[model samples]
Target: MKRRPRRSVPALLTALVLLAGCVLVTVVTVQLILGERPWISYDAVAATLHDLHWTDLLPAVAGGVLALLGLVLLLAAVLPGAATVLPLDGLFDSGAARGGYRSTLRAAAAGVDGVSAARVKLRTRRVKVRVETSRTQPDGLTDAVRAAVTDRLDRIGPATRPAVAVRVRAPRRTS
Candidate 1:
């Protein structure tokens, strides 16, 4: 039940920046082709660059800020996200299912004979079921819980068949 991670914000920002740059370049090129002076004057730009000081704190700060922004975007794009919802298949309309399947599997395990309570964790590739038993041996309880879980899974017909693991624990007797 793990959904794929995504970094949509960084991608969107990059697309917007590229689009703005393209539009600016296209506008400047069109103005030059029509023999009209664009807003940008090369002489003024060259003069500004010539007078720029290498020790300017503003440019250094701006470069540092840009570098930090790039690092953040890179991390956003690279980091893996925690996903709990998964898309279910094998139906006419695709739909998303969350992790509530654990409850259903737990109930199925609890229904087994000699099981008092059950806990289930359903993952993308595996299903883990734990049961508390007072009268049943751990080995027999594990087998029973595993069979019930298997039957439940077969009935539900999930898109993917993950391996199932069952554990039985003896409940502590009250003094």
Candidate 2:
């Protein structure tokens, strides 16, 4: 079935850039504090971080966590409809046919319009597909990923719809 185009993400790159900047700043701040040099300056401060040890590592770990959170938030905010988060074991957890089916679905998704990359994975009973698209809108990308995945799975044979979860991600090349 033909689909109607929805709003496109003209400002996605801008939003992502901002998100990245935020993450960078946050991470730097936390890391510098952990390093015993919280201030940003031309001259390096007396950072006797050798004594910081595990406590210092907390910020590094937290920075990683915060950065991950930032990226995840950015992705969800920027591409909500296109990306679906599912447990890693959802799709192919059952057996080979299901695993293979998901692979085929991923390949088909990769071939769809606006899709730059496709990753299909099965976790338990869920089929999660992460699709990288040139287009940024989550809704539009989700629709495309959904349709493509559904069509591909249907073509595979008379089986269930297979919990088709979708995620639309901006192409890494653009970032």
Candidate 3:
């Protein structure tokens, strides 16, 4: 089973723009039918459009801007976002499970000796663990963190196990 895709921001913005345009047109039409002055003067707009030329700088700039906006919206709608859930061996998957998996891996890395702080990044094919320690000689810290994280990943039993990479950083000493 695949995770549900998240809503696109550009798609939402496009909907809002269309809704606002429809509301504006409806209000103008109702005002015109009631013989009341509309918010926007149609006659003036018509006159301006009639007098405007395609070669004019303003029209060219406006057309270019609109084209660019359309292209951006189209790309945003067509692009797929990053995966949100980690697939398991069976047909079971939930947000809670993903969170638990991440936390478990992070805890395992942080539990290693000489690791003062641990940060884990879970990707589709690789898990990166960054550990910070105050020890001057952090020789075996990276291997320890990697082994611990790998062990946890094995226990979790994800459908596709990601490779684990560990990096140990020690705080710089000040003179």
In order of listing, the candidates' clash counts read: 0, 13, 0
Residues forming the 10-long window of minimal summed lDDT in candidate 1: 91-100
Please report, in order, the local distance difference test score of every candidate based on alpha carbons.
Answer: 0.78, 0.63, 0.83
Ranking by TM-score: 3, 1, 2
Tens digit per residue, CA lDDT, model 3, 62-158: 9999999999887776776556666667565533255677789999999998889988887778998899999987888888998999888777777
Residue 123 alpha-carbon offset, candidate 1, angstroms: 1.9
The local lDDT score (0 to 100) that residue 11 gets in candidate 1 is 91
User: What would you estimate as the lDDT of candidate 3?
Assistant: 0.83
Regions of model 2 farther than 4 Å from truth: 1-99, 136-139, 158-160, 171-175
Taking the tens digit of each residue's C-alpha lDDT, what string does model 1 give over 85-131?
A: 55455755443444566777888999998888888886668998988
lDDT of 2 by residue, 1-175 (tens): 1122222453575578789989877876887778865445423433644445665777689889889977876765565342222222333432234445567888888888777888988654567998876664545768877888788766654223457888777734444
Model 3 TM: 0.84
Question: In model 1, which residue pairs have backbone atoms overlapping below 3 Å?
Answer: none
Q: How far in Å is the alpha carbon of 46 misplaced in model 1? A: 30
Ranked by TM-score, the better of candidates 1 and 2 is 1
Instruction: Report the Cα lDDT for residue 91, model 1.
Output: 50
